[model samples]
Every structure is written in structure tokens, then in C-alpha cells.
Target: MSELKNSPWITCFLRPQELLLLLMLRWAIAYMEDPAFPHLGDSSQPLPRACPWRCSCPRDDTVDCAGLGLSVFPDNITKAARHLSLQNNQLQELPYNELSRLSGLRTLDLHSNLISSEGLPDEAFESLTQLEHFYVAHNKLSVAPQFLPPSLRVADLAANEVVEIFPLTFGEKPELRSVYLHDNRLNNTGLPPNTFLGSEAITTLSLSSNQLSYLPPSLPSSLERLHLQNNLISKVPRGALSLQTRLRELYLQHNQLTDSGLDATTFSKLSSLEYLDLSHNQLTTVPEGLPENLTILHLGRNCIRQVEAVRLHRARGLRYLLLQHNELGTSALPAGTLRPLRALHTLHLYGNRLERVPPALPRHLKALVMPHNRVAVLGERDLVSARALAELNLAYNRLASERVHPGAFRRLRALRSLDLAGNQLSRLPEGLPPSLRSLKLQRNQLRALEPELLAGLKKLRELSLAHNRLRVGDIEPGTWHELQALQVLDLSHNELSFVPPDLPEALEELHLQANRISHVGPEAFLSTPHLRALFLRANRLHMTSIAAEAFLGLVHLRVVDTAENPEQVLVQLPPKNKGALSPKG
Candidate 1:
């Protein structure tokens, strides 16, 4: 070869075109003879300079084509793309070989489309060997798409029309960790035994809003969270969850679970369980054998009549317990039933038939809701142990003012809100906590308000005294002077003939609708400079009684409702301003 190159005949005798062809032939021969040459067939083509039309390439490896109303996938997408989002489009199909070039793709989102099972072929995702997360939710898929990548870790198929899921639908996907199949039509017959036996690595599985009538015993042992809410499941046989020892959360609300269907031994083996939701079921009593580490339990809207202390003794770590809308009565809860719940912080017992409050509440309890009951009395010992209580709701009950003990709420120094509306109270209860910020006393029979009734409520901000029999002399002078923080007061549906005097200067809203007030003067709102809303609707005011400048001092007053009074009375008030007054007829 050196001797041939040294001779000048080859270069001097050949034309330019022939010389180029000779060099190309020599290069090709050298590549064929040498085994160390790298393959350059795929990389020889230059990458596209710009992203596809109507799409954005924020990075060199990401493509966002969401919400484009596209009926077909874009052509010639860069094969180097690792993330592609085509959600909220009109595409209906994912045919085979359509994504063959995107073998390196790791995330693909096709949510909120019209794609069905038939639109996606068996090998639609065969080439995506490196895919990790796949989202196909909110579509029209009637069956599980086949040939999902083995490397997939998360698959979302929620809000679809999938009626059946075969045992091998997720064929041998050992790396799959989360599978969302909620809002489908899957029933017990469609889900055969061992449907999830192959998915050992699945930690979260959502099968909610289905027609399953029984709990499946084929759940994987490594599963940690399972959601089966809004299903028709009526039975949970013994040892149903024996294999799932690592389960931590189970949601079975809105089902047909009864006391007989739920065997206590089924959950004793799940030592790691922390949350359980069995609300809206048919059980007549609290379930037993709950895990000791449980932190939350929801059993609302059931037919449970009793909650025995033994049933909750093992769940010492429970912090939240909801038992509202049941058939429980005063005798249903025995004494010391809640004493073992040392960590309980929130308890909901509203909408029951109890005639008295439960005793021995946890000292650390923060929220206690017991409204819509038949309790007629509130004794001093009702809440003595709840020193840390911040919220207490006892509205819509049969409580009478004479029945409440004077020191019923004196121990609750941390109380901030107290609701006692829709009762038969004739007077204000004594010894109310001074830390109360909100007090609801509406729809009662109170006839007067003395100065001593609100003497220590310096932090009171809102007070509702509507729908009472209070008259002009009901409110004494300086009745609300101590409540410097008072901002809202509602005295509507009363018999008061005039605006009460000595209101707090910080008052922002005053409601006195359906009263007998027939006159108003300019000094009516002189003390309330920050008043923004004043309602005097359905009063007995005449057109000539109200002074034109009655609201002049209220610079912040914007909303005034004087309707249902005479139209002549409305014409006597001052002309409405653009930003100050918005009087309604």
C-alpha cells in the first residue's frame, strides 16, 4: 500500500469525480475489514432543529402536547424524548408501531382522552422497555390494555369503563408498585381468584366505586394500602387479610358490611394498620380486634347502637374517632367506655338519640361535636375533664336554660367556640368561659339581656341572639360595653322597638330584621364607626321617622337591607352612594 501511494500515477492520471469514488471505495473496504469500527447507521441522521408545531419542548428530552384537541398523534417526534404528555386531547387510538421509536421514554401521560381498549393494540406499548410511569385515566377503556412494559412502576386507569381484569392483565410486572383501577365496573365474578397473586411488589391498589360484593382473599402479601370504598362488598370473611400483614390503610366506606360479615380476627394480623374507614355501613356495633397502632377510625352513618370499652381498649393510639349519625342513646355508652382512649383528640357523636352527654371524655380532647341530640340538661360534670377543649357544638338539641348547671363550662379555659342554637333556653347560661370567641344562641326564648350576663366576655367577637322575644327594655345600658372585641351581633326576629344603645365601637355588622323599630335618629350609629353592614328589614319604620343623615357617620357601611318595610319608608332614607351605601328594597 505504501509503494502504491508513493507512485504519482494514481493522483495525476485520475479525474476529480473518479478520485472521489476511489477514496470512498477504499474507506468502505477498510470499515468492512476492521472489526473495531463503530456502527453509525442510526446516528448519521441529523436531529430536528426545532420542536413539532403546536407543541413545546421546554427541555431537550421533554415534550408537552396537552390540551391541543388533536385527533392523531404527532408525526416524527424526537426519539430522544424521555417525557411526553398528550392529556386532554381527542385522540382515540394507540396503534402498534406508533411508539416504537420511543424506546427510551420513561413517562407517558394520556389522561382525559377518548381511547378505548380496542383502540390500543396488544403490542401498543411493547417497545417502551424503559417506561416507568404510565397514566391512562379518564378514558373510555373497556378492558385492561395488554403488553404493558415490565419496567412500569405506576399505572393509573381510573374513571374508565373497564368491566373485567384478567389475572394476567399486568403480566409478570414485578416492578409495578401502584395500580389505580377506581371508578370502573368490576364485579366479583369478573375478578377471579388470585387476580393480584403475581403483583407482589404492589404497595397501593385502588378498586373503589366498583360492584364487588365480597372482599377478595387474593390480595398480595406486600400490599400496604388498599382502597375499596363505594363498592357493594357485603362480606369480609375470616382470615381475609391474613396474608397482607404489611397493610397500613384500608378504606371500606359506603359498603354493605355488617357485624356478621366483618370477623374481628380478619384484622388482628394486620399489626401495621393505622387507618380504617368503615362509615356508611350496616353494622350495629363497633368492630373488634382493631390494630393497636390505629390513629384514625371512621364509622359514621351506621346503625351501631353501642361502642363497648373492650372493643377500643386495644386501640390506645387512636386520635380521631367518628361515630355520628347512628342509633346510639344515653344508655348505649357505658361509664368509663372512653377512659382508655388517652390519645383521643377529636370525637364526633352528633345526630344520635342520646338524652345526655357522654361522660369521662379524654383530657386532651380538642373538638367535640354532639349536636342534633335529645339532651335536655347540661350538668357541671358533662365536660369537666375536657380542660383542653377548644370547640364544642351542642346545637339543635332540647336543652333548656334552667337545666344547664352554672359551672358547666367554667373549666374549659381554652374553649374558643360554643354553639347552642335551636334550643329552648329562656336565659343565658352562667359561668361561660371568657376565652369564648363565638357564641350561638339563636332560635331560643330569651326575653332579656342583663349587663352581668356578658360582663367577662372581653374576647367575644360574634354573638347571635336572633329569633328571641327581646323587647326595647330587654337590653340594659352598657350591656355590651365589656365586649370591646365584639364585631358581629344578630338580634333579628325580636320585638325591639329601637336600635340598642351602648354597642361596641368595633361592631362591624348589626342585624335587627323583623323588629318593631318605628324610628331612627342620626345618633343611632354614632358609636359604631367601623360598622360595615346594617340590616333593618321588615321593621315598622315610617317614611317620615328616619333621619336623612342616620347613616352619615358610618363611612364603611356598604350593605343595608331595609326591604319588606313600606316603599314609602325607603324613599325617605338618604340617596344611595356609589361606594358607601347599597340599600336594597
Candidate 2:
């Protein structure tokens, strides 16, 4: 065997399956070289049980023969298999030690059977000293007994009828690292006062979805990750993680963390921490003094109001900062508030009470989100258009005028999409970057759209002018004579009284929702032979026939979003211009 393994010619001449078997045999020989686990031979057998399952096992260290309607454990199994799974059987009481003859057993999974918590004997698992993993989850255990292994590293007692953990139940397993005690009847107050008497050996812990409003004063310093999310955790011990210097990731999201619970020193000692998620909480005020090493901070869907991240200047590595849905007004961000975070790329300040625009924003920011705010003006010279800015979203603001400075976007040559929908604007602004591709101005107060406002956008492809007071007379030949690259045009939610003529030649998506359009005027969409994704949702149309030639006019019409139209609007199937429409249709 040794000569064959070292022979280079054997590797080149053997098939894949033959080579794999030889490699596995050689690997096992090298791994089991320990004097305690000797190899067996055909002539003179040694450690004969280890040869029974050298292969053909379902998973690593686990062998499942459960629900086979057997009366006793499979006696023909090998000793090398660490875990033996036999669940949902007809055993009333575990005949302890009958299966413990194999001293190499590491895990014993016996769940969903007729074994009750009261039926467990005192010395059930006391003999299995080498056992490090056990799974009794989803069983009929009501009261946990002191039956555990001293060398245990992980134990799953979850999804059981257990009421609480006794103080002495896990006291023997001082080396236990992970424990799953969730989804049980263990109340915070009903815990055995000394449940964590020797819990210092643990590194990763989870007590989520429980009745815990607070935690114990002391925790294991070796813990690197702790999850206390989705529970009644309203408060934690002062500087709860102060001693956990090695902690890298902590999940406390979806908890009731208020100002009192989160303070400046909450993460003062967590210098090694990297990822922290405190989103979906009732934090009314901004939590200050965050760990400087934090990379991704998710504070979205919380009650955080002001941009009062006092010491956030230290978070230089922050890439994504989400502060959506709060009482944050634009005034809260002082001049140069975000200028230091040059590395920041994505900023979500949506759904706030911002009154005016901000200045001196991060120059290298890629995404700028200020949607659903009370913004009336995107202040001039306030914050120079960052050339690196790609997406600008100011949707659902209170902007009424064309106050956006022209130079504000000249430097933003990377701007691809601009959303100014749900605002009070009557007309689009100028100085739109030449690189602009998409502009969303839906649900605005515009009565007319001047052609020159959009003629400068040479690369403009998608434009949404829905929910406006636009009239049919607002259309003309110069509407888009210069924009040869125009494609998707949304004119929905407007009081358009008439249908225009000869829309953009490349027009694809046309929206005319919530309008008073009565005339499907002549030459309408005649230039658009590649129109698609047309929407006529909610409108009053006086032109009922919508001539059969009307839809046959366009060649590439597809995906018409006219599902929710008002009673007055008429519907019709559009035409297709072979190869004239987009290939995506």
C-alpha cells in the first residue's frame, strides 16, 4: 500500500473513481495513525468496528437510521461514526449504556420520540464523557434533568416542552461553547439563579425570541458574537459589552433599545467590533459614540430623529449609513457634517421632516437619498454637485420651484437617475447633467412642461411626468426634437385635456394616468415605432374608438401598465414595429 501511494505512474494511469478510493484509504491511514485508534487488517482484525463505516455515511460524524421501526440501536454500525441519530421510535425509556459501549461517540440525537423529561434517569448521559454534541430538540421533554456530558461543546435543547433550565443541569459541562435555549417556557424571572454559574467557557451565545427584557450583569469575555434580537430585550446591563473586547459582531436589532439603554459608552469598549445592527427599534434619539471600527450600521425603520451622531466622525470606514424614517430635518445636518466621510458611498436619509436642502455633503458619495422629506429647495452652491454622485433621489419632497442651481449638476457627470416625484414643482429645472439618463417627476404640480427644460439632457432615456395638471396644448414639435435618445415617457396622474402629436420617435413607455385627456390627437405616437410598457391608468378620455390603427402605429409595444384606470379612459392593444422596438420586449 505504501509503495502504491508513492508511485507516480499509478496516479496518471488510474481513473477518477479508482484514484479517489486510493486517496481516501491513504488519507484515513494518515489520520488514524494515533496509537489509540489502530487500523484493522483482513488477516488480523484490530479496531474492527471502525471499518464498518469508513464510507457510505450520510453526513460528517452523523448516522441517521431513525423511524426505521426498530426496537434497538443499529448494532452493526462502526465506532468511527461520532453521531447516532434515532428519533421518533417506540422507545419508552433510554436503555442507557446499552449504546454507550462505543466510547468514541460524540453526538447522540434522539428527538420526537416518547421520551419525556420526567422519564430521564439521573445517570443517563453521565457515562458519555467524550460526547461534545447532542440534539434533543423538538421532543416531549418538559422538565430538564441533570444529564449532560463534561466534554460537551454544543447542546440543542430547543423546541422542546422544557419549562426552565435547572441551575445544576449544565454545571458539569464547563467547556460547552454553544447553547440553544430558545422557544421554551423559560421566563426571565423563572431562570435558575445560577444558570450561568460556569458559563465563562462559552464564546457564541443566543437567547433570542425570549422573555428577556434585560441580561445578566456578567458575560463571557471570550464571546465574539452575541444575538439578542427579536425578543423582549428593552434594556441591557450598563456597558453590557464593555468587557467583551474581542466581540466582532453583535446583533441587537428589532429590540426596544431606547436612549437610556444605548449611551455614549455602550460601545466604548467594543473596539474590535465591526458589524452592529440596531435597526427596527424605538430609539427616538441618535445613539452616540459608536465603535469607530463599525463598517455597516443599519438604523433604518427606527424612531431616530436628528442626525446627532456626535462622534460618528471616527467611523471613517463606514460604507452604508441608513437613517430612514425619522424626524430628521435638513437643518439637523450642519455645514460640513458629512464632508469628513469621504469613503461613505451610500446614504439613506429618506422619510424625514427636512425643511431645506443640505450643504457640504460628502463629495465622493455615490447615492444621495432625501426622499419623503419637506425639501422646498436644493440650495445653490450649498453642496457642489459631486462628480462621483451617480443616483440622486429627492422624491416626495415639497419642492415647488426650479431652484436647483445649474452648476449644482454640472460636476455630477456620473448622475444616471434623478427622481423628483411627489413634489410641488410646476416645471423641471435646467442644468441637468448631460449624463442624466432617467428623470422621475411624477405627482408634481406642473401645468406645462417646456421643451428646453429637458433638451439639454442628450442621454435622457426615461422620463416620468405623472400626476400633474398638464394640458394637451402643452405639446409641440420641439417637445423632444433635440432628445433623440429619449425612450420611456410617463405622463400619468396629470389633468392632460388633449393627446399630443408625434411623440418622441424612440418613445417606449407612455403613462397618461389620472388625466382629463379627451382627444387622442392626430399623429399621436406616430414617430414612436418602438414604444413599449404603455400605461393609461386612471383617465377621462373623450376619444372612445381609439382607432384600430392607433395601437398598430407603434411597432414594439409590450407590457402596458393600464390595469387600474378610471372609468373615463379607453383601452386598446398596441402594435409592434419589428426590430423597431427594443429587443427586450
Candidate 3:
């Protein structure tokens, strides 16, 4: 012991208190050297502490206390947290001077909470100078915050009871880019004139689903996308959108806009505009002076009676045009009205009073939906220019099979989906497009699918013939043999006494409900090995009539709806066959 004490390194045995202090000093030095350690003793930065009890520290700079039912903020939150999420919680208020300690916080999500106007004190967000994103949507705040951090880039207060926004709420933040205040109660009186005048960097704004009766003229010039749908807006003042040259998208659907309410030059200055939706209004004619760069326009569900060709002459780059549910007739659209839209791809004119297809359809049209019209004939030249058409929906039209020209669709090599349901067709249309992948013939008059009708449709995937008078003999043995890729077959509500034979080998879903089928043979589905869903409900299927080997080869079958039959089939099945039967109605 005397020799050890005499050594240089081990001078002597010190007291316990002094030795403990020396060990702590060594640990403090190592802690300070660590690059991940948060600096201590900085008055401006909070000291690092242990993670809160009910919270999680997924990363060194993130704390998540979401959906914890925390009415009061958790304690011991580290000051180094940069992303704190307390959404979907019962937190009604934040403690004063508590959140101000997180000086490095960049994003705070408190959405779906009970934070009211009084609960969110101004100081709660006043100290967060570095905060860039703040979300408090789906809350009970009746008014917006009077002040926000200047560094905020996005503020989402949607689905709140906010009826008023202070003048300085969003005007002072120069760096603010996006503000979502949709589904609020703000009206014209509640919004000041200079609400968004100072935020020059603002690009996206949403004020949809509000009670505003007119367009707000206080929008920032840098806005790129603006959503104002589902409002009481009836008129758009001239130059309301003229200065928004950089704006690309404008949604004004579900409003009370009329022909007289809009100015002739309302949309002439939006040179960069690409999308404009003015559907569900009271317009009697197509709006004039549309933007030249507009690509997609929605004017459906209106009182439009005519489409002036000269008004759309400048929209040469239009790709999609919707004019459904209007009062347009065959003469409303003049000749050569749509020839200028060279880039047009889709045109919808359904639910109209047209007696025939519109003249001078665009040559590059890909989809034409004209269902629920008064057309009685499919003329030869009706679709001659639509060679690039891929989809044609003429359902619920007053057309008969005899009125359709034999070679009406012969040149359409790109046609893939055809809907001729709810027509007076007695048989399948001859010379149907071979590239067809879907054919709907339900709610029609006749029966008997000719073998040659679908002989070339090798790529057909869906065929619906429900609510027809097709019998067992109507569907021949090779009716579906050529459809090598067919996967869905709906023959429900038909006059079939038995299941049709020779189904496609790749059939996966078979709907034969509400038929006159009385018995199921053992080889009913022996050819379809890939069948997964079989619907045989509301038929004449009985427990004893269905052969025991009906589902022998169906290894991958998951659903077998046999309800509404004469007897319970699933209950009578043996214990070993229970897994194969799922009674889904």
C-alpha cells in the first residue's frame, strides 16, 4: 500500500466524494466531444432532456405524440426536436412558454385536435421563427390566428370553424407560399381587400367550400394553383384573374355562374392557363374569350343550348372537352365547330337532345361519350373521321341494330371499349372492331351471339350481356372460345335455363345471377381453372340439384355466392367442404 501511494500515477487514495467528482468530469468531457450531443447551457437553446413518457423519439430531432389522447402536453420533450406531431389528439391548449423552448422546430402538426381560438395563444407560434410548416386543420377555431411566423412556408387550417382572418394573418409573411383555408365559413365581408397582398411568394391557395358570393380580388400575383369550387360565387369581376398570368389551374365548379354574369374578356388574359372548370352553373351558352393555352375545360351540368364555334377557335391545344347534361341539339354545334381542336383527345356530350352524332368531330379524338341521346341511327359518315378512337359510349340511345350501318366501325382499328347497352339491338353489330377489349350489350332486345361476331376479338377481356333474352342455344359451343384473354362474363338477368358452356379458359369472374338455371352439371366449370369468383345467387339452385363435383377442380375459388336460392346450400354442405363455400349474396 505504501509503495502504490508513492507511485506517480496513483498518488494516493482520495475521498469518495472527490473520486466521484473526478469520474463525472471525465464523462462530461466525452459527452461534449460527441457530435450527436445537443449543446448545453445555451440560454437561447433548450437543454436536451429525456423523451416524454407517452411520446416517441423516432429520430434525434423528431418527437411524435400523435393519437395518444393527450389532453395536456407531455412533459420532458427534448428541446432539440425539429418535427413534432401531436395530431388526432385531445390537446385543447398548449402551456404558455412551453413550446417556445423548441427553437429549432421546423414543422408542427396539430391537426384533428380540439384547439380553439383561445387555446392557441399568439405566443404559441410567435417564438417559432424557424418554423416552416404549421398544420392545425380540422379544429374548432372560429377565427384564424392574428399572427404567424415570418419563415412559414405552408399553413393548413382547413376544415375549421374559422369565419374571419385578420388582415395581418397572412399578409406579413413574405416567404409564405401555400395557404389552405378551405371548408371554412369565411365570406366576402370577413375577408379584407389586402388579405394576401404582401405575400409575393404565395403560389397555391384554396378557399373552396365557403360562403363567398363573389370572387376575391385580393389574390396574390404569384399564385399558380387556385381552388374556389363549391362556393356561392355568381360573378367574376373583370381583371379578377387577368393579373394571374402565372396561374395554371382554376377550379370554379358548383357555383351560380351564368352567361350574363361573366364578362366577355373574363378569361382572355390567362395566357398560361391550362385547366379551367366552370361546370354545374346556369350558363345558356359556352363562355367566350377562353384562354388560348387551355387544355382541359369542363362545362357539364349547365343550361347551355349552343356552342359557338368562333369562341373555341383560339383553344386549339384543347385535349379534353366536357359538355354533358345540356340542352344542345343536332343544330346547336355548327359544322366545322370542332375541327380546330387538333390536340383534342376526349369529348363528352352525353345526356343531350341530339338526334345524331355531331358533325365535324375532331380527327384525333380518342374517346366520345354520347349516351342518353335521341340518336336513332349510326350513319356511315358519323364516325368516319374518328379513326384514332379507342372508346365509344352510345348507351341508352334510340338506336336499332338495323339502323346501324354494317361497316360503321370497320375502320376503327384502335377501338377497345364499346358500350351499346340500353339500345334496340336485336343482334351483335357486324364488323365490330377487332381491337375491342370490352363490349357491353346488356338491356338489349335480342339473343344469339354469332361465332363470327367475336371470332377476331382475341383481346376481349369483359363482355356483359345481362338483362337479355339469351337462351342455352343462343350461346353456341364456340361463342367465347376465341376470347383467349376474357376474364369477366356477366350473363345475369337473362333467360338462360342452364349455364352457358365453352367459357373462356382465362375467365376469372362469372356472374349468372337471377337466371332460370335449375341444375349445375359436374363439368359446368371444368374448363375454367383460373376462376376465382362465381355468382349464382337468386336462381333456381337447390342443395340437392347442385352436383357434388361442381366445385371439384376449383382450387383457387375464394367466393361462391349462393344466397337467395330455394334452399340453403352452404348449410347442407359436408364439414370437409365448408372451406370451399362462402355464402356471399
For candidate 2, lDDT tens digit of each residue in 1-585?
567556777788889999999888878776776455544553454442332222235655667767765545455566566887777665555665655555678878776566677656657566676988877776677777666767888887776667667766665468888877666665566565466567667777766666677764566777777877776777767766788888888888777888787667788788888888888888876577777787778787787656643557778777778888876765677776666677788888888888765667777888988898888776656547366888989998877676666555666778999998888887777778888888888878887767777777778898888777777676645887767788878776666765566577877677775666544544666778787666554455433524445666654665543334343334455433333322111
Q: How close is candidate 1 to the true structure, as a TM-score?
A: 0.87
Q: Which ten residues in a row have the lowest lDDT in candidate 2?
A: 576-585
Task: Give stretches of model 2 more than 4 Å off.
Answer: 1-124, 127-147, 150-163, 166-178, 182-203, 262-264, 280-284, 300-310, 329-331, 385-387, 402-408, 481-487, 497-508, 513-526, 537-544, 550-585
Candidate 1 deviates by what RMSD? 7.5
In candidate 1, the residue pairs with backbone N, CA or C atoms under 3 Å apart (3 or more residues apart, or in different chains) clash, namely none
Candidate 1 residue-wise lDDT, 1-585, digit = tens: 445434557777899998887777666766655765555554664454567689999998898999999889887678889999999999899756767778889999999999989887767577889999999999999988756877989999899999877666664789999999999998987777767656789999999999999997778888899999999989997778988889999999999999999877968888999999999999999988988989999999999999999999999999999999999997888778988889998999989999988888888999999999999989989999889999999999999988999999989999999999999999988888999999999998998888888889999999999998999797888888898999999999999999988789999999999999988887888889888888888998766767777777566777877778765465233344346543566
lDDT of the candidates, in the order given? 0.87, 0.70, 0.88
Model number with the top lDDT: 3
lDDT of 2 at 585: 12
lDDT of 3: 0.88
Name the 10 consecutive residues with the lowest summed lDDT in model 3. 2-11
Could you give candidate 3's per-residue lDDT for residues 13-38 as a string of tens digits?
A: 76778667756665676677677666
What is candidate 1's CA lDDT for residue 238? Answer: 79
Q: Model 1 shows how many backbone clashes? A: 0
TM-score between candidate 2 and the true structure: 0.72
Tell me which of candidates 1 and 3 scores higher on lDDT. 3
